[model samples]
Target chain A: MDKRLALILSEVFRLKEKEINIALTKADVGSWDSLKQMDLVLTLEREYNILLTIPDILRMVSVAGIVDVLREKGVALED
Target chain B: MVALVTGGGKGLGLVIAEHLLSNGATVVVVDRDRDALDALPTSVFGKCLDVTQPEEARTVVASVVKEHGRIDVLVNNAGVIYNEPLVNIMKPEGIMHDYGRFREAVTVNLDSVFIMTCAVVEQMVLLRTKGVIVNISSISACGNEGQTAYAAAKAGVNAMTVTWSKELGRCGIRCNAVAPGFIGTESTHQALSVDSIKHILQNTPLGRLGKAQEVAQAVATVIENEFINGVILDVNGGLVI
Candidate 1:
């Protein structure tokens, strides 16, 4: 879960792997705007081939929440 | 009063050339179609030149300047359109889709604008001539389906307008763009019926198609309004919300 969350965060926010922290939230990253959130959702859908609902997207307000949604969608998260 | 308009042989370019010529500005109509160039009125100095070629642009601008002694306005109006879903786009399947057509569209639509503008601007700056450059952009620039390359290219034009407005502002050259929505041109009317037009109109606030002259009027306003620079005027009747 930590590794997958870090990878997604790094790719979506264009940050280095070392720069991403599991505790990061919307307020923690300046790049986490509404547009970037939409882009993140789209990227996750395309990369994992999982159709996310509006509720799922809205619930993913933090890195841990994104991992929770991915787990709910049956995506295997590497610890 | 010399002015150069690429693709001035037909469509919006033809209307803009006529408007400028009617205002007593000597016009040079550049197009790849010699027949179309010949079809222009005698008042216009027509030349068959493919603007994609940088050398050709320089040569034509020089010829127009030699004959008219000055270039007061330049309108980069030549463009092409394509419709294909981004994912299903064949024939140059790659990162950007339709790589061949994408390359050609970028060259003709975006690069040619840069080539012509640079060529004309060099002369304008050397002669210390204050002039106007109006790039014809599309509402698709905002983001539309089946227009990945076209959108990127037109967006490039919009960005260039802003950058050039600052770079050449000191030289008294104003750069601006016009983003037109779906207008009821001959081609558009043929492609779309009254019912389809109504759909677009329903989406648009004005509830009708736009005339080419309306777009020309917007361009003319940009040209006449000296203070107006780095502006991407929406002549779409508020279609783009």
Candidate 2:
């Protein structure tokens, strides 16, 4: 897992790095409810200094999905 | 620039639309009055919309985004004013007031402002476009006799203007409001008679009613000045001061 991505995931969902996976989704994670989804959005925005619209939010459903969108935004997840 | 002015079909709204158009923005004006929409020039796009409906608010924002690609500014100028003393508003027998009128006043003035601003700002955030929102509030926001609904709603507008500015400013968006005092418009004419206008002017320090153009200029100033945020610029000829 990319270190920054793991950091955000852990901070947003209060999870350990070992528990997270690319396939992990809001449905799979008990803490990833709607409110959590919004919180994650704000957290991602604050961390990345990027803005996501409703459509962008709808597309980012899972950890892998978030990684993909972050890549599209040119965020350096590896560091 | 792309701008949307609610209640653009008539009165001050119309003037605001014209000002934006003249300033080189692709202006979209929405109003519930079909006749008012028809009155707009061919150069401007006019939509007959009742913004109080959440669905309509969504659709308008979506279409504006699709067609214009971005909304640079939003002027929430769609509103109405009605005045009837509380005593006359107890229902069933009051000659001066009706509950329906109060509901309509708030719905049009305040509720629509809330719905439309949220819809527009959502898209603005998504686009990552720095935008400006100017809400049309009123001096009655401070409070006025027989204007409970109008006062509450306009005051709500001012409050939201400040709140959104703080919340969204980090996203490169700014929210501000314009509170006009006795602007000359068809709506004003409907709300007050000549004698009432005269009395208001007499009490006003400036000794005159404000013009819609003055209000439009204040709105434009807030929109242009990037550093200004969360301000309720009054265009009332220093009435309250």
**Clash-forming residue pairs, model 1:** A1-A78
Scored against the true structure, residue B142 in model 2 reaches a CA lDDT of 94
Clash pairs, candidate 2, are none
Q: How well is candidate 1 docked (DockQ)?
A: 0.02
lDDT tens digits, residues B1-241, model 2? 9999999998899899898888888999999999988888998898888999999889978998998899999999988787766543113244345679788988888889899988999999999989999999999999986687889889889999999999999999999999999988877888775656766888899898888889888888999999999999988887862
Candidate 1 runs further than 4 Å off: A1-79, B89-96, B190-196
Best by DockQ: 1
Q: Per-residue alpha-carbon lDDT of model 1 for B1-241, expressed as tens digits?
A: 6789889998888998998887777889999988898888888889988989999899989888888887889999988765444543112224235578778878888999999999899899988999988899988888765577778889999999999999999999999999999887875776444544666888998888899989888888898888999999998888963
DockQ of each: 0.02, 0.01
Q: State in Å the error of residue B109, model 2.
A: 0.8
Docking class of 1: incorrect
- Clashes, model 2: 0
What residue runs in model 2 are displaced by over 4 Å at the alpha carbon? A1-79, B89-92, B95-97
- What lDDT does the true structure give each of the candidates? 0.82, 0.85
